[model samples]
Target: MRTGMTLLIKFILTFVSAFIAFDLLLNNDISWILLLSLVAMLINYLIGDLMVLPAKGNMIASIGDGLLAAITAYIFDLLIPAFTTSWSTLLWFAILIGIAEYFFHLYLKKDEKVAP
Candidate 1:
């Protein structure tokens, strides 16, 4: 693939993944997901080499993302008197993230195999 295309996909996927993860963060509203995603993306981008493989990078990202997502969800629930959450919200968030991850991986791998 062309370098430009790869970078573009990376930019788009990063935004999509972050947005979905942020939404999954709550039944109500909280903004911490924004900060958390920014932090995680920055840290990972800076240390991308340390991750070595896609799986390793994903593992690290997932931990940071998942924890931050949970915190954001909880905080949103805490602040909004009218908002309610289910214990299952966490599970749904996890599932949604997992799906997002799988698709992102597929897209990346496909891009790598295709001609520029």
Candidate 2:
């Protein structure tokens, strides 16, 4: 239940961020944004939240999540011809995700079951 809730929140955050940064601003396709959000959420949840958050701590974990988001976006941009974005835009998107993840990490830390 806890993990489900966490993923839900993460998805919401990722979707909104990607929607604003990619779809709304850059005129990217909604379908691609949706796919990006899901992939980014799962990867960040597994690597950043589960592994890094528990081992390294919130600051590091959030940074990792941000980097993961940027990298994921960059890779998608490369693979999908319709997904267009610049480096500065990617950096801005990363910053947004990082800020959200910081607060999210705080919430996760409150729950003992989340970390260990």
Q: Who wins the TM-score comparison? A: 2
lDDT of model 2, residue 60: 94
- Candidate 1 versus the native: TM-score? 0.41
**Residue 18's lDDT in candidate 2:** 91
> What is residue 46's positional error in candidate 2, in angstroms?
0.8
- Candidate 1, residues 6-116, lDDT tens digits: the string is 445544544445555445544334344444445433443334312422546555555544444445555555875654456676555545544444454455556655332
- Candidate 2, residues 1-116, lDDT tens digits: the string is 77788888999999998988897779898999999999999999989988998899999999999999989999999999989888877987798899999999998888777534
For candidate 2, the per-residue lDDT at 29 reads 88
Give Cα-based local distance difference scores for all models. Answer: 0.48, 0.89
Candidate 1 deviant stretches above 4 angstroms: 1-30, 39-86, 113-116
Q: Please provide TM-scores, in order, for all candidate models, with all chains considered together.
A: 0.41, 0.93
lDDT of 1: 0.48
Q: Candidate 2: which stretches are off by over 4 Å?
A: 113-116
